[model samples]
Each structure stands twice: as C-alpha cells, then as structure tokens.
Target: MNNFKTESFDLNRAFLLDSSHPPSSIVTKLHPLNKIMAEGQIHEDIPLLVMELDNQAIAFITPQLAYQHIVQGVLNGQAWLVSFCSICNGGAVFSPLVDDEVYSFQEGGFYDAMVLLYDVQSGSYWDHLTGNCLYGSLVGKELKRLSNLLHMSLRQVLAAYPDALLALSALPEQQQTEAEEDEAWRKASEPEWSKGLVKTLGVEDNRLPRLNMGLGVWTETTRRYYPVAQLYAMNNVLIDMVDGQRLITYIDPLSGTPGAFFTDASQAEWQHNILQLNNGDSMRDMVIFDANMMLKRPQRPFQLFVRWYSFALKFPNCEIYGQPVNTQG
Candidate 1:
C-alpha cells in the first residue's frame, strides 16, 4: 500500500495545472441558481455536493465540478470551496480560510494520484480530499472542513429543502446538453475512463481494486473504510464503531450513496429505501429523523463517499470494515 507523506513534495511531479500550459482549466467564480436556470437546469437525479448553511440548502453540481475541478464562492458570508476529482471519484466542501484569511484556489497539480489545489493567495499546495496544505508558505496548515457536506441528488436535496438553491457556473453557455451530462455521469460512475491517471500514480495498492467505491469516515484520531459491496451483503445497513463512537452506516437508497450517523440505537434496518430505527422513529434521508430519535442526533461524523485506492493511500492505517483482524497465535 502507498502512503502520503508531507515530506515528499516534489515540484517536478506536482503536475502544475495552473501554469501557462496546463492540462485543463477550472471555474474561478460560482453562479447563483436563478441566473443559470434559464440556460439549463441540473437533472433532479444528478448527484451534487451539498451542504446546509444558516438554514439554507445549497448544492454544487458534480458534473460541472468534475470538469472544473474546483469552484470557490461565498455563501451565507462563509467562504466555501467545492472540489471534485474525477480520477479519484472523490469530492468535498471546505472553508477556504487559512489562519482566518480568505484564499481563492486554482488547480495546482497532482500528488499521490489525487488532485493538489493551490491557493491563489499563498500558492500553497493542498490535498484536495483531506484539505491539508502539503507544500509552500502554509505547508502545515489545513482548511476547515464543512462536516455536513453530503453527496445527494438534486431531487433528494429538494425533498430535504424544497427551495434549495443550486450553485451554477458563471461561464457563458456553460450548460451541457443531456447527452453530454449523461456521458459525464457515466465517466464518473465508472472509473475505467481514468487509465491516463493510473499512469501518473506513484505506487499502486493491490488490497482493493483501484476503482472500488466505498464510504470513508474519519475523525481527528481515526479513520475507517466501508466497502459498498460488503454493506449490501449485510442488507444495505450496518453498524460499526469508529473513533470511539457507535455509528450506523448504510447505502442511502434515495441517492445510492453512503451515509453514516452517530447512533445509540441497537438495531436498524433498511425498509423501502428508508431506515427504520429500533426506537419507533425512522430516518428519511441523511439523518432527517422522524418521531422519537435514538441517535446522538447532533454528532454527524465527517464522511466521504470515495474510491478504495484513494482512501487507502491517504489513510494507510484505516480499518477496513469487513477485513479480518490478525492475531498472534
């Protein structure tokens, strides 16, 4: 297995995408929902990177983020950065403030087979998945993660908040046709399109296939990865302990993505795409509890719906949910 180290910063291998001759371009500004609604609207079923701020539900279209790689914006007076790496099939929402100073970002390059984002203000490179500054003036700094970020469909987002705002692109005629959107979704769903990225990886971890998708949950002290296949094998719902907290994790039926929440409920089951908590109440989607709740309620851990190789490399010590424990005989 390969591990990422802060000490291994090489300028030559940084894959500087912001330089004059770059591989691709990124979106510098984010647009409001109403402005782009006339050109085209995101399909309700299309997955988006979303978060709730100040009782307002905001979403970042993933297809656009896949092409642009990064989008920076100010929402509810908070500076946010929504990022997606098509190669790694990973996405996250982050606060762009480092040392309480706001910073914009551009695609820097690639490190450890993942996207490295550099702040336009300090030119410091950061790991897109973990938000940790790797090299430059803010080498040891970290971007604050918006813990409530979830990968949900526009439909699911709307269900949660009927008037949720969709974040769009400010670029003129940036909307893709239905065919183009389908192609982008297909490429993201299947990682076979990333053969070129495979060539750029420094090392390969063979424990799990490079394209296997899973949910990776982490806290300041520990991390764990739960393969989707194993979750399905266990009836699409399972309970596990991570970072000293009991968590109920499942493949969300509405969006076909994974979600985890801190719960004290002893038993849970997936019934008709809704999770039934043993305590008479149920969870609709992403911990929207109905009736009496048995969960800790407020402590939703930081989780990422990511690929196996991506999580395995970044968190080398992560526990695999179904992996057998080894003991000395």
Candidate 2:
C-alpha cells in the first residue's frame, strides 16, 4: 500500500454529496437527531467531537463553523459559542447541554459563552466569546486544550449515531422585529444563479460551498454579519469581511464569476481573497457598522463597496487583495 499520511480528516470532503469526490472509506454515521441541520434556519445546536483522522484530537467545537473563527484557545476550556444576547433576551440560543460542558468566568460574565443574535445590529463584540480574554493567538493553542478534555478520541466515535437537542426558547421582542427586517431584506437581493437568500437556506445542495458558523443560517436578523464572514453555508460565502479585500475562495467551475470589470477574475481563485487584498492594512481604527442600522431592512452584501469605505480618519490606513486599492470603489 502506498504510504499516505493525513493529519486530520476533512468533514466536508468526507460528507461529499455524490461519488464525484472519491470517498475515504472511513464513514461516520450520525443519528437523525445529531444529523439534524436544515438550511432554512442555520442552527449550530450540536457539540462536535472534532478530532483528527486517526485518534488525534481537535476539540469539542460546536458544528457552527461560520461567522466565528473558533481556534480553541488555552484559557477557554471546553467552551460553546453563539450569537445570542441574554440580557436583550432577543439573541440566538446556545446549547445549554454543550454550555454545561464548557468553562465559565467570574469577572461579571454570563454562563452563556455563545449568545445568539436576534438583533444583528445591536450585537456587541466585547460581550461575545471572540473577545474573551482567554484567546491569545490564532495558532492552535486553545484548540489543543479543548481536545484534551474528551475521552474517546473523536475518530473512534466517527461512525457512531447522532445525539439529541435541549429545550431552547425563542429570541426576545426587539430581536424578532430586527430579524424580520433582516429576512425581508435578504429576500430582496436574489443571486443571479439562485433565488433570494431566504429561499437558498431551505434549498440544500452542495451547489454552494457552505460552513455553519454557530449562528445557524443567515437570517434577516443576522445578515449584518454576513458581509464579514469567514465560512460558508448553502454554497454562498456567509461571513465575508473583505472591507478592503477581494472575495474569491476556489473556483466553482459552474458558479465561477468571470474576471469581469465589475467582478474581477481574481475573486474566482482565492477563497478569502479579501484577506490577501488588505495584506498589510491595520485594523486598529477600523469601524464596521451595521448596514441595516439605518435602512431598517435586510439588503445585499456590501459588494458594491459602500460609502462607509470612504470614511476619512486621522491615521486610517487600508488595502485590499494584497495591494493598496481605494477602500471605497
């Protein structure tokens, strides 16, 4: 046998829709409950036993891979993340069972590390898990700690069945109103290849390269964060934060946007091209406001490069696609 070494198993490559992408033969089966994830509502409600292909450990990360970039830091012992706001009572719901498994703080903190966002505009970064003091660097420092807590290496449980979900309440009032507005706006902007955003969530096809950021699907309520996404869901790039960068991951031969003037060919190649565009740009003074905070409705992504990009600051420096281009196109 050829000696091939794979450190970690790719969840996406393994969950291929068809046989086009060769199977690794190592299949993990989940129960109907654990495997429950509908596109219409992108809910990241389960705790994923993430580990490497063999017995190597990753961490107890919720299947929510989009919106938030969870690297599992040292201080954050077995934590859960969501976009909910407990005080507002209008945020998304965090898996209480999963939360019980994670650690909590005493510096006047909420037991709920991951708060759901019923109101995307009112979301506060400092209150969220991303800004937690535990995370130091992006490297795998925290992920390693989270992995050590699990007993049966994730690999062993790979082919096992799924699990169950706990009782979770709905988002509060102010949050619901915002969510509806966000939903209304999402439906307004329809992608050329598919229907509007709302419809796309319900229609599941490998057509869109997707990743679930604990926030579930892109609801009108949470569409504000969609502009700065890092993952995919429903084949559409959910969290695209390319303020001064370009947007292109890999080439989806079928859905690939040509190197046109309005849309560059560069976006068709690289996945997070936005990162490349703003290679040396500093995010110190950068301020990202909710697009709908003023409109009171959901709208298309900030693709056309809104006027906010033109804001003038004292030492504001920016770039895109690796080169220094106009922040406001």
- Top lDDT: which candidate number? 1
Model 1 Cα lDDT, one tens digit per residue, 1-329: 11233456656555656533232233344454544444565554666777766667677777666767777777757877877777677877788898888887878877766777877777677888778887888877877777456788765665566666776654345445543554465456463544545555655556777778889887776678888998889888998877667788888886788888887777899889778878565777664564655432446677778888888777765677888642312
lDDT of 1: 0.70
Error of 1 at 273 (Å): 2.1
Q: Which stretches of candidate 2 lie over 4 Å from their true place?
A: 1-77, 84-178, 186-318, 322-329
| lDDT (CA) per prediction | 0.70, 0.22
Q: Which ten residues in a row have the lowest lDDT in candidate 2?
A: 306-315
Evaluated against the true structure, the overall lDDT of model 2 is 0.22
- Residue 328 deviation, candidate 2, in Å? 14
* Candidate 2 C-alpha lDDT tens digits along 195-248: 322221222222113221111111112112121122232242212334333333
